[model samples]
Target: MKPVAILYDDIFLKHDLGPGHPECPARLQAITESLNDLRQDERYIWVDPPEASPDDIARVHSPQYVDWIRQNCEAGGSVYPALEGNLVPETYPAALKAAGAVIQACDKVWDGEWGGAFALVRPPGHHAVKSSAMGFCVFNNIAVAAQWLVDKKKAASVLIVDFDVHHGNGTQDAFYSDGKVAYFSTHQWPHYPGTGSKREDGEGNGIGANLNVPLRAGDGDDEILSAFNDRLKPWTEERKPEFLLISAGFDAHEDDPLSEIRVTTDGYRQMANVLKEIADDHCMGRWVITLEGGYNMKALGDSSRAFLEGIVG
Candidate 1:
């Protein structure tokens, strides 16, 4: 089996979220440093990702929104008042690179060149909508990759699993009417963005394609893992997706200050193991994981390592 490819670079750390922001560069730095020892092993491969092409990013985002981001970045200031996230000139390029990492991971995995790929990037996506950026996300990386797969006829159906503490409202909205992409998420109820109600299964043809497992603020490993095993597993079985994408986030960990969902590092491992089994059974082990939200530096590094170990071990 080929080694799991990790798409990473220092450039990702350059998309500054500004001082005192929870989504800071130190998060990635912690993860990178924790995985440093693993880099010496042949089972893992680290490679820098190229910048995402604007045309490809347009796959899931509006052209006008894309241009607006460029203007915002070029203007050299933060984007959207109240968002609190900075958007320096380098932000646009960094966002492209972050998104591009996922695209390249998909390409490499689809080409049978890797067992799987993990895009360890910043300016974390998933909250980015088609028309605008939100929640510290500048671009919807996983969404764009899923759209690209469908556009290229690479996969008839995709399974997007979001383990973020917050609901991926942007991703859910992007594919709410498209049956080709089935989004399953486990998040803290009444959390940030406030959008992943169980009632919001899907819309139109995509009805029944979306599943949301909203946990209480203090929900922990057993509760969260049960949702994965009982709900997400069955959903994937029914859909039998041709590709698997994970919006991997560690903010749900017990130590993370961002949310109250108390999932442990072991919980992340168990979740990844289940997802890996699904991929092995349905998609020939083709899986792509991208960073999302993880605030506690310690938990982020530990849980991330556990998740990767589950996938590639």
Candidate 2:
């Protein structure tokens, strides 16, 4: 079997939010510690990705917004109210590496150099919009990668599947009016960011290209798995995407402090299995998974390990 690439960099650890923020560097530390055993396994390979160029990021973000972020980071790191985090000098470069990691993962998988790849990055993106950062994310890493696949790689169609507990408002907004990319998300409704309603389908050329399954606060593994099997499966079969991208978030884990959803580690495994089958059937197994959110360190580590195991199997 072809190995899966694990894209990571120590620079990610330098993107510190604050002294006592939820999105801290320890999130990656916990994940690395949990997956330490995988380093000895031939099925996985670790890679250090290059920083994303300005043009590369411009695919999803406006030049003005990008410049604003860079200027702020350079000027002693001010806090953007929407981002809800304190940005240090390292934040901009770390965000660049984060997006670049996802782009590299897509290239490696699309070139058949690897069957799949997981971009272990932070700060978690999915919440960053085109104009500005929000919800502790600097750049919309997965959105940038999806656009890269469509624009640079010339992929006919790309699909983004986000299972984050919070709606991927940034991702949906990125492709809401574009037909070449499809966005699907299963998130908790009446939650943070307050988007992702069933009635908020795509518009214009992107009609029917966006799908959202908003679960309740107490919803658990059964609800999420059913959404994947019943909703996402049929939607994917019709789209038959050329490339698949996953916004993998473990905050839905039962032990997670951020949300009430009760997804367990095994739940993530099952979801990964389903997503892998979809990719294998339609995309020739061309897919990349990028980290999004999971506040509970132990839950994040364990759930990520389980998901990778399922994907590799």
Candidate 3:
């Protein structure tokens, strides 16, 4: 079996918002510790991620917006009101690497250098739009990678599956009208950023390409899995994606403080299995997963480990 690449670096720890910020460096630390045993396993390989160039990011974001973030970070960092967080000097570099990791993972998996890749990055991106950051996200990492696949790699079609507790408003907005990419999300509705209603499906050429299944506050693994098995399965069969990208957010875990969803470690495992099967059947097993939101330390760690186990198994 080919090794699964794990993209990570210490710079991620430096993109700190503050002492009490929920998206803290410790989150990555906890996840790394949980997967410590995998360090010696031949099936997995950890690699440092390269920074994304301005042009790579500009593929998804406007050039002006990209310059704005760099300028702000260089000028001693201040509060980014839109992002709802502080942008320290290190934030810019970390954000670049976060997006770059996903790009690299896409390249590796697409090239068959790895069976799959997981980008363990920070400043969790799912809320960032094209022009501005939001909900603590600096750049839409998954969106950037998705665009890269289409614009540079020339992948005819790609599938992006987001299972975060909150809607990936940024990602959806990126490919909402583009038929080359399909965005499917299962998130808690009437929540933060508030944009994942089923009625907000795609427009124009992308009319049926976007699928949103908004779950109620207390919905758990059963509801989420059903959405994947029923709604997403058929949707994917039609798309027949050339590559797969997952916005893997574990915050929906019952133990997480951020949301009311009750997905367990086993739930994530099952979800990964389903996703992997879809990739195998449609994409020739070409897939990449990038970390998104998962606040509870233990839950994030355990759930991530389980998800990876399911994928690599």
Query: Each candidate: what lDDT?
Result: 0.90, 0.92, 0.93
Residue-level lDDT tens digits of model 3 in 17-108 = 87698989999999999988988998999999999998998878888999999999999899878877789999989999999999999999
Error of 2 at 9 (Å): 0.6
> Model 1, range 1-313, lDDT digits (tens) per residue?
6989989988888888777999999999989988899889888899989988999899999999888888888888664643466788888898999999999999889888988998999888899998888898989999998998888755889999999999999899999999999999999999898999999999898999999999998899999989988998888889999889999989999999989889989999998899899999899999999999999998999999999998775
Pick the lDDT winner: 3
What TM-score, over all chains together, does every model reach? Answer: 0.98, 0.99, 0.99
Q: Which stretches of candidate 3 lie over 4 Å from their true place?
A: none
Q: What is the overall TM-score of model 3 with all chains considered together? A: 0.99
lDDT of 2 at 266: 96
Q: Provide the RMSD of all predictions against the true structure, rounded to 1 decimal.
A: 1.1, 0.8, 0.7
Worst 10 residues of 3 by lDDT: 78-87
Question: Candidate 2 — what's its lDDT?
Answer: 0.92
Candidate 2: list runs displaced more than 4 Å.
Answer: none
Question: What is the TM-score (0 to 1) of candidate 2?
Answer: 0.99
Residue 9 miss distance in model 3 (angstroms): 0.4
**Candidate 2, pairs of clashing residues:** none
